[model samples]
Target: MSFDDFYHAHFRGLVVQLRAYTGDVAQAQDLVQEAFCRVFARWDQVSRYDDPLAWTRRVAWNLAHNRWRRLRTARAWLLRQREAHVAGPGPDRVALEAALAVLPARQRRAVILHYLADLSIAEIAAQEQVAEGTVKSWLHRARAALAAALRDTTEEAQDA
Candidate 1:
């Protein structure tokens, strides 16, 4: 398919998929656009791939994770300044986001892919270019970390 047709057909699905990682529609849209731009920039190469959609999704997923990492570094600096804290009660979203932000990037990606995107471990392994066993290990560690991180919040409350 042509790039225009391909983009029009798959962009929204990619955006919705990215939303799970970002938990924000606007950010998801941005991630999708970035992914498309990457693919377009390398169209000669991308078009030769057997599954360009998978490549696009993986690109979006990776970008979202990178953005999350950058945010975490910035937030960590902000958090270190006890006096610079945003005063007053913040949204519960802050706590949830902070917890997620602290997870190791690979573990977070595994959890987001397995639970948030409802992908199987094998699928996650393929997207991440890791072994299935590694994906399982990541998932196990992620579950433990998330449980420890969000000890008080109801797990049921955080579904996107």
Candidate 2:
């Protein structure tokens, strides 16, 4: 088959497969287009192969994988750079930390475990060597104290 005929026959199917694999239509189209360009460059030999479509499909998939790997590396580098540029915690976090400090030690530990650390009540109970009910009570009381403290801070700011 002519290169033009071969491309027309397989381009959409290849694009669809690449799109499903890559989750990006534009990227899929570009990969498929580049794959066809490569195949056309060597069509004299490729057209004689047992399965030109398979060869084209494999080329497109390889292009997609290479692109994904490059993007993943770039994203990791960006995230590391972003970590360095991150700003310090703001006033609300400061106020919340101060409010947390005023909680009794056990209550503070329980609150930090259950909420900040995302531990379950039963897990906190096991960690703290206390009953689940005690952890629950500490969480309830700590939440109330934090609410009251933050509210007071907000009120003081308004008054000032």
Candidate 3:
């Protein structure tokens, strides 16, 4: 099917799928558009897939997840910083963001998927294609790192 036809046929369903994956309706709609944009950008290549719709859905889901990770990370950092400033003796956003920015990719993804996206450990494992134990380990490490980051942020704020 042509891109236009695909867009018309699958738009709503894709949005719903993305929403389920993201746990956010607005992000899902944005991801649906982004998915179509990607499909059109590589139409020649992607169209050859036997099940292009599924391919698009997969890509869109990944995009939605990536966007969520980025936006939420930034927002969380900012909120922490703002709170730190208001608390007059707390962690700052910059220190926290820098700390979180250093996490290994899998640890970061596991943490975001579980806590921010409200996904279960099993769900995160399936989405990330990792073992559930791996996801759990990543989560444990991420939580430890977050605690350390918060401490560093507070220390830095105090020193400032």
Candidate 4:
């Protein structure tokens, strides 16, 4: 069968199967689309397979599994970060978040990974896919900016 014909015949069923595997309709759809892209990339070989739809389903399920693993890791990391901080959102927490918001994106990320997430410089470097020195520089700049902002806030409050 032609690739387009196979896709048209199997897309919805593959999406339904992936949704059962992932328990998320949108993620299932995304995984199925990604699987189709892969299949399209190797249409010559994939179309020749005895069961192209089976191959697509396998790929989609694998993708869904990988996504689930990544999400689990992220959720665990978030839980750890929450445990590192106090239980409730207090004024100080609000002020600190406001200060963090003023930094550039990279700097803010560095600060969060280092201070809030409690990741080591090496860990942050790996996660950011940059050199350790670059992570250090970002953290240093973030700290300076945060200190200045918080100091200004403090001074303003005192004046009030």
Maximum-lDDT candidate: 2
Candidate 3 versus the native: TM-score?
0.48
Model 4 misplaced regions, further than 4 Å: 84-160
Q: Write the per-residue lDDT of candidate 1 for residues 1-160, one digit (tens) a residue.
A: 8899889999999888888767899999999999999999988889889999999989989999999999999999878876855676565767667777889999988888887899998899899998999999998888888777777565545663
Predicted structure with the largest TM-score when compared to the true one: 2
| Candidate 3: residue 126 lDDT (0-100) | 95
Candidate 2: deviation at residue 26, Å? Answer: 0.9
Cα lDDT of model 3 by residue, 43-152, tens digit:
98888899999999888878977887999999999887784444443335566567778899899888778978999999998998889999999999988998998887
Q: Model 2 off-target regions past 4 Å?
A: 84-160
Error of 2 at 153 (Å): 22
TM-score, model 4 to reference: 0.52
Task: Tell me which of candidates 1 and 4 scores higher on lDDT.
Answer: 4
The count of residue-pair clashes in candidate 1 stands at: 0
Question: What TM-score against the true fold does each predicted structure earn?
Answer: 0.52, 0.53, 0.48, 0.52
lDDT of each: 0.87, 0.93, 0.86, 0.91
